[model samples]
Target: MDENYSLAVPFYDLWHEDGHVPLIRELLPPLLKGVERSVIEIGAGTGLVTRVIAQETPAEIYAVEPALGMRSVLVNRLAEDPELLRRVTVLPCGALDVEVDEPVEAIVMISVLQSFPAEQRAELWRVLARQLEPGGRLVFNWRERAVPVPGDLEVMGSYEVGRHTYEVAGQVLEVAGESVTSRFVYRIRQRGVVVSEDEAVVTNHWPAEERLVSELEAAGFSRDAAPEGMEVWRLP
Candidate 1:
């Protein structure tokens, strides 16, 4: 995978330590209350949200993450809690590809939707729709945008991840005699595990909230906006 993403595991842990866990813990319960008994978390990333869900709800939990590195961390983190471990199944696969033996009461995407390309996001929604039992719920969050539309949907909830401010000092001169300076902005991962510097390609698609509503409607869901940082779509 991408080295940058691979290196991100450590950074992701650090990011969560800074404050991501509390934010996720705060927003998760309301969504959890709407579901019945089972919950599947797509892109579970080291179980930050999973831990919260397990603690707050009585539902069974299944966490899916495609990255080996992140999965390892998740497994280790849940190792001590035999009951939670028994109730949870950590799979190494993306949400669009996983097969569940039984229908689920709810499917959560959390910070995962932004990581998908447009097509993947659509496919993921479709897959989740199929997995839902009648009246099942899908809950997820995205970065908020100042403009009605943003270049990257990932930037919408960007503040949750925290911002990086930095300065540049020296410049490099090319053979042509022009001096250039480079500046970069970084985002901190608030909760969950992230594989950075890996070969993985992380893309964000922020189709407007209306677009998401329309898509859910097309997929046979009635959508509602939740104040805790996500949109809730319930199967009709």
Candidate 2:
């Protein structure tokens, strides 16, 4: 996992609540209807999607998050709800190293695929497959994307936090085959003056639909119909 999230943790929920969380709320519940045993959430950031999964089912949840900053918020979020505190377990480990006591019924990875590069995806699929029961579902958000063109910096989101405003800006720095290197700038302003600023250069992989299908298929997964931007596959 990219430890870069340590820089984005402060502004994550503020940005994603309106970005992709709503789509997960709409498209993921149906897939969990019969999942009553256990479920694993790969990149469970700050308990947003974890809360959604908890509400939809009574299954035991293993929320895997490796970033210390994000995991702290996630643990605190779960503490607020006594039921969630007892039902959810937070794993402080990366995807390739994470493990569960037993195979789970389903696995959810929302906006997490980009963290794995083309070279590691095969190992990722293999790791995930080992943790799931045969026929268990692997669900995540994915959409085919055209290669990006390098672009200048642009402010992606700005939020008011009490007397200060937090701003997140980004720029596409370079594009390699399936990897896109980008820079994210985080700034805090007080009355329009920049107070504190931090930047992180991260690389994300966006494989095409055909490549994704090929990889998943090679790992013994069969695709299932899902909403336009969502993907669901079953381990056979």
Candidate 3:
């Protein structure tokens, strides 16, 4: 099954009103330090991290994304900033499908690894391995499964950008097998009356850290020093 997140695609940024922009900008500089040649970012959703990487790193960046709706937003973001437009080349495809002529200095997939199933994780690593230059680093997060707990719902306070008001709510949908699914509901009100509503269901895999490290090891990667929940692997 494909990792489709098109339901709440229109308001994807709206749902993330938890001061994510500054947070990511602050966190990305350290992750991309010491890289000067080139970098590739997978699943560059809404170009948040991609934007930061472009700004912080003096390297050419290739951002691969499969979702059309998110790509639309990404393109808009690029257009708004000429510097980002000049530095980044947004590819309309997933990581596995991207074609890199030269091995990259780094591969970044932040908050995106959990979307791949365990069976597919190996292949994903293999594809990324082919794109990495010797001594290249691959950084991503390994999320732990902690959702769908009985009667748990988050009221993600409403937001108003000019005239359109967004009321967002979320809850854990289920914990099935190796994946935990979360659902987000967004209601758009132009003038109080409900104009539109959307639901986005996202499922993420949370394999044991040991299992993931083993998979990476099998794919010829060595773990680097990083905080918990972060995986920084090097290609030999």
Candidate 4:
């Protein structure tokens, strides 16, 4: 699955502007405060989470994102604010491309693990294992399927930004084993007239929860007690 988030950058804001803000604001602070060294955030996206981290923690941050369109939007946010610029470094790279001078105290991936192509997911986990310092934390969330091999349609919701109205609708395109491919169609209109539209098809690698925990163990992580809806791990 090739996801060019650059093409969807314009609608990215409409789709998820502050969508995960409360979750990020709530989940990230305690984790960052626990880490004495730096924190690296995989898939920084539009940088709202990054902004929160910058505001809440004193730790330096590596905000890694491979998509230029999303990166530009996030970088612009850093430029617009002194706080983000002071503590955050926007890295133009993805999971495998990560290389930091110092081993980090934490590695966070929010809504990023599923996007890794199925073939490369093992390596992705391996990289995550290697990035953290001993006793360091790895925090992430998984895409939950209501049932095995789900094929369903979702309204996804819509919103208005300024005078423009955006409607986001999506449906399941295919389900292969544990993985599901979905299609999203975005229609932007002004004054009830369609102005622009685009569509994106994404396939996520979703395995069963047991298998996922097994994979993380195989990648050299032992699970630590974590809150519901999140996974926390520590390196031996």
1-236 per-residue lDDT for model 1 (tens digits)? 32434445644555555555677778878778855478899988878888888887778888998887788788988897897888898978878787788889988877777566555656777788888888788888865543332122132122233433211111122211111122122333324433221222233455566666677787788976687467788887
TM-scores for all predictions: 0.74, 0.97, 0.89, 0.91
Model 2 residue 198 CA deviation (Å) reads 0.4
Per residue, candidate 4 scores C-alpha lDDT tens digits across 1-236 of 22547556777766675465577677767656666558899998988777776776677899998888788899999999887688888888888989898888888888787776667877988888788888888888664566444456566867887998887778888888777788887788899898987788887777778878888898988988765667788898
Q: CA lDDT, every prediction?
A: 0.66, 0.93, 0.80, 0.78
lDDT of 3 by residue, 1-236 (tens): 23346665666677653545555555557878999989999988888888778877889999998888788888899999888888888899877787888999999897678778888888899999999999999988664654446346676767887898888777877887778788777788898988888777777787877798799999999988876556689998
Which order, best to worst by lDDT?
2, 3, 4, 1
**Residue 201 error, candidate 1, Å:** 7.4
Q: Pick the winner on TM-score between candidates 1 and 3.
A: 3
| Higher-scoring candidate on TM-score, 1 or 4 | 4
Q: Residues 1-236, candidate 2, lDDT per residue (tens digit)?
A: 34688889999998898689988899999978899989999989888999999999999999999889899999999989999999999999988997999999999999989999899999999999999999999999999887899999999999999999999999999999989999999999999999999899999999898999999999999999898899999987
> Once superposed on the true structure, which residue ranges of model 3 sit more than 4 Å away at CA?
1-4, 17-21, 145-147, 150-153, 190-192
lDDT of 2 at 105: 96
Least well predicted 10-residue stretch by lDDT in candidate 3: 1-10
Question: Candidate 3, clashing residue pairs?
Answer: none
Candidate 1 runs further than 4 Å off: 1-4, 34-36, 147-202
